[model samples]
Target chain A: MDLKQSARDLAIEYLLQEIKKGNLKAGDKLLNERKLSENLGISRVPLREAICTLSTLGILEAHQGDGTYVSDSYSEIFSNIIKKYGIFDRSMVDEVFEARSLFEADAARLAARNHTEDDLVKLEQALKKHENALTDYYEEKLKDKDMMELDTEIHLGIAASSHNNFILEIVKSIRYVTLQQDYFSEQYTLDHEHFKRSSIMHREIFNAIKEKNEDLAYKKMQEHINEIRLALDIESIRRDIK
Target chain B: MDLKQSARDLAIEYLLQEIKKGNLKAGDKLLNERKLSENLGISRVPLREAICTLSTLGILEAHQGDGTYVSDSYSEIFSNIIKKYGIFDRSMVDEVFEARSLFEADAARLAARNHTEDDLVKLEQALKKHENALTDYYEEKLKDKDMMELDTEIHLGIAASSHNNFILEIVKSIRYVTLQQDYFSEQYTLDHEHFKRSSIMHREIFNAIKEKNEDLAYKKMQEHINEIRLALDIESIRRDIK
Candidate 1:
């Protein structure tokens, strides 16, 4: 590597080391540039570049006149990353769904094993909200945004029930990207039939988790995603024919 | 949200819109601060804040004195995000492995369907290198880093064979995080038996891919990961007992 690249790498390594050692943490404001550069034995130029790199990675937040801070939420970082990448093409969308299937299936399995009473209550509440949203939509009383938010809530509730922070964050990221795309895409639509089928599938998944049936939960979650994938594929084909 | 947050959001939305319209491309140098701010009808402070946010998210790169540019690669952004998050605990490790299982299985399935002659050649070359590295290690002639690199190369080759750039990139990101953690962790080690089993599993996966047996390839890939997970679990248990 050239001198510039090496310097940036050194800076990255130093910062990561600090984070790993707990010298830096999420939501912690970084020290002033001059002090940090001096402490790391690097000049201000490379130090700034490194900080800029970290910021671009969504690991740090820079507020004007407020200094830089480590990001407290991985979900925000993930949503930003997805938006930046613009993963909306058909193939990319398919890949995202594939990822979601895996993540949610594993999440369902874990939730079956790990959920507490509070989690069960939250899951039921989310499910009820989703069911009510679907009912309102079918009755022509709900907006798309409301249904979308409710749909996201139900999936996120199951993810949270897994009791694994990492899984929760990953699921949130995937859901954010998928929902953002759906919200913005003109081709995305939810008819009564799709909503009806989706509601039943959601209930089955919820029940499987509630019963603590890990295998059944995993299978149901996978089937739920596969159905969605099939619906998306059909829509794409219809668009193509149109 | 506060005024500052709203301004930042506006800036982010504006930039993302520009990107989606192909007005901005990867590696394209961003316009000067004054010009961009003026064009957006926003002041320099908010525009700069927006740029800083993009920079932190790895969507843009800032050279020392040169103008900022869109990142050429998303993998760099992903690596930075992973490092910043520092997902190293047991549950996080399991989550990462779950992600890998999903990603690699999908990649393997796609590779089975999509591999061209050239891809097969590359895959064979990577597998051969891995096999050689394992042999050398068992003969006490190789270092851990060498074997690790070879192992990564084999998986990356399979990902590349999938013929999907998005899948390839996601797999690369997952592997980078997992390998980085393994490289730095004192708990990570590979014994001869583990290498032997891994070699067998890799060949099985390769053969399944070569034969265009998608189901078999997926199954083998999942099995390969499960074996690794089992080995890690066993090691953790042993550590706990000791």
Candidate 2:
């Protein structure tokens, strides 16, 4: 490895070690450029590059004049990476949906286990929108776009309610990537069945949550995805790619 | 809902429209900071933040002096996000094996269908490394630590030799996330069974490639990952996670 690689590796190694050791607390600021460069025994370039890279990872937060601090916002960093990388081709959409099926199933199960009053209110609100949208074709398109976001809101709400940051963050990251993919946001008009099935799924999922039935919630979530799978043949996605 | 989110939502909506409408092309330079800020009627602070956020998503690439450009490096950006999201968790070790098994099985099948002398040589070199690692545990640690990089070399070699960037890059991203995860580097004695089965798997995969037995090659790849599932356990991971 040349000087640049060596410098970068050293810096990365040092920082990772510090993170692992808990010397770098979530909100602790790092040493400034002058000291950091001297300590790494390298010039400023590679050190800055590594810092920028870590900052991008949400491990560091650079606040202009305020220096770089270890960050608490893992999700923001995660979304940043997803926005950049998770753009997919048509066939990859099938794989993405497969992942989503598994992810949302778990999210629903967890949400069911921990639905607070606030969570119930949000869920009900999303469901009400679906019902209104189903009443008219023109209104449906206007609401269909927001439907996915609301759907995401419920799933995210469940993950948030699960009180597991690790799983919640994972679920959120997966959804973010899935939504950014070719398949998830593909232009579509909702048929009566599409709207009816969606409303039913949410209601069933909500009932499961209200009953605090994890298994029932998970199953319904899977069923919800299976419904989409039946309508949108995975193989048909390959045709779109070509 | 506030200024920051308003800016973010508008930026994403505008960019998505541009992407869909062909108003923005890959590698197109984004409007300069002043112009974009002016157009959006947002302060330089939020506009810069939005552009930086988009750049982090891999949609835009801000070259220091050259202005921000739409990225040609989406694959890397995507891979970085996947890695950052902990998509390579202990759970994914199993999933990676499943995905790799499916992917490499296809890759081997493809290689068998179209193996040149060079492809065969590289495959042999990969097998040799597997063999050498079993005998030389220290080197294996380094190789295994960054196994995705090595795996990428062999897998991409197969995909590239078959001349499919789309298949190559997607599989390449999904395959490497586990190897790039911090969990991979945590101290663990190499499982002898893992090394043994891996050796057997590679030999069979290579033979299928050499003989052009697509079915056999693919099956061997699947068998390889199936064995890997039994060979590694990562509950030790929970201890290392912060």
Candidate 3:
């Protein structure tokens, strides 16, 4: 390994531990390059790289004359690190699923309550794409990947229509973080019945939104997320992990 | 400015424009170091630095034996940049308000439907502290600061009691992102009148939770977030920015 790379990793590890211990906070400018070098026993070159890395992850900030500061709090830092560990890690998946359930449920409720005509059009367009992907049903090659992508599109559409950028951003991030695991797999191909059920559920959610019934929307959204949970066989996975 | 940093800013600015124009995407790796230097008319050092910065942002990822690939989609990149900007510019307050409105409303609904006796005690404790802060009605001199903090504390308390870590984490992160607005100036001094009213609202929310009336609890939480909306005045600020 390169010296600078090792040094950069060290800086991240040390800073992560400190933040985890609550030794740092937002706006607390970080140590200067020279001082950080001295403190970490690494050269300024690698320390700067590490600081810059964390800065990108939103855990640290760089000021022209001042210094780097720990920016994000522990939980935020944990979220980023959790991404690095990948989604198949049962705990992370559980966390993501749990988070998604909360978000999607709320999103559905909001969309149902406040969806405008425009929101409805966008949602219908997304549903059309999902339906189009189903045309390849007999051809197993495209079934799995297409379904996942379609599912993401539908969810993203719902989040977008809810008019909440923050939730959309987080949900988008969640999708990115879990891309390798869920976006493409043979499951959609193998579980044809599940795909049919999911299609019906999507249609039901759309109808609920169209009817502007927040309760039905929330319930359907919850059921949809729970369906994914069950399809992933997460309950068994969670038990196995424990 | 350092040469590499100057190079990085230029690269970032360049790449951001490309992303905005929809010219880049995931899995699209850039040219080799030598080729990129030739193309951009810069030395390898600056090019490498720029790529590293983008890489750190998770927009690009460098493969040891391969090239640099855009690790994120354009929307993901934009979201990160926007989120960071919100924090640095203090617009995160609005972001927090939007998210909290949704989360709190949902949490209230859930808590009312799901709260146990233990949950009641915890909610009661938070309410008590809120009342205590009111009695100590020394005007909190800082305006922007301390606004969402206890709000977050109360939120976390409710989320924790609601027994939903997903809600807890998102709410936690929303607070985390906004806290990036370094506590610069405190906004309003505690007007005894205002504090008294706020205390009453807290009590109202408490009573709703105690009563386990999901609709009432949700309505109360919605009103609470609106009150905070006025306190933060996020929507107007966003309008002003645009």
The fraction of correct interface contacts reproduced by each prediction comes to: 0.09, 0.03, 0.23
Error of 3 at A95 (Å): 4.9
Error of 2 at B235 (Å): 6.0
- Candidate number with greatest TM-score: 1
Worst 10 contiguous positions by lDDT, candidate 2 chain B: B83-92
lDDT of 2 by residue, A122-233 (tens): 7777677666666663444554446666667666776666544444655676666555544443443323356567777878988898789988987898788777666554
CAPRI-style grade of the A/B interface in model 3: incorrect
The ten-residue window of minimal lDDT in model 3 chain B covers B183-192
Candidate 3 TM-score, true structure as reference: 0.57
The positional error of residue B218 in candidate 3, measured at the CA in angstroms, is: 3.4
DockQ of 2: 0.06
lDDT tens per residue, model 1, A15-109: 77777678888889999988988787878766776776566556677878888898775466666676566444345565566667766887888
TM-score of chain A of each: 0.67, 0.62, 0.60
Report fnat, model 2.
0.03
- Candidate 2 per-residue lDDT, tens place, B43-133, comes to 7755655565556456677676688788765556545555444423235444445445545555566667766798778777876765666
Better of 1 and 3 by DockQ: 1
Clashes of 3: 8
Please identify model 3 stretches exceeding 4 Å from their true place: A1-95, A109-122, A176-191, A207-219, A230-232, A240-242, B1-82, B85-95, B109-123, B138-151, B177-192, B207-216, B231-236, B239-242
Over 4 Å off in model 1, which ranges?
Answer: A1-74, A86-90, A183-187, A230-242, B1-74, B86-90, B164-166, B183-187, B230-242
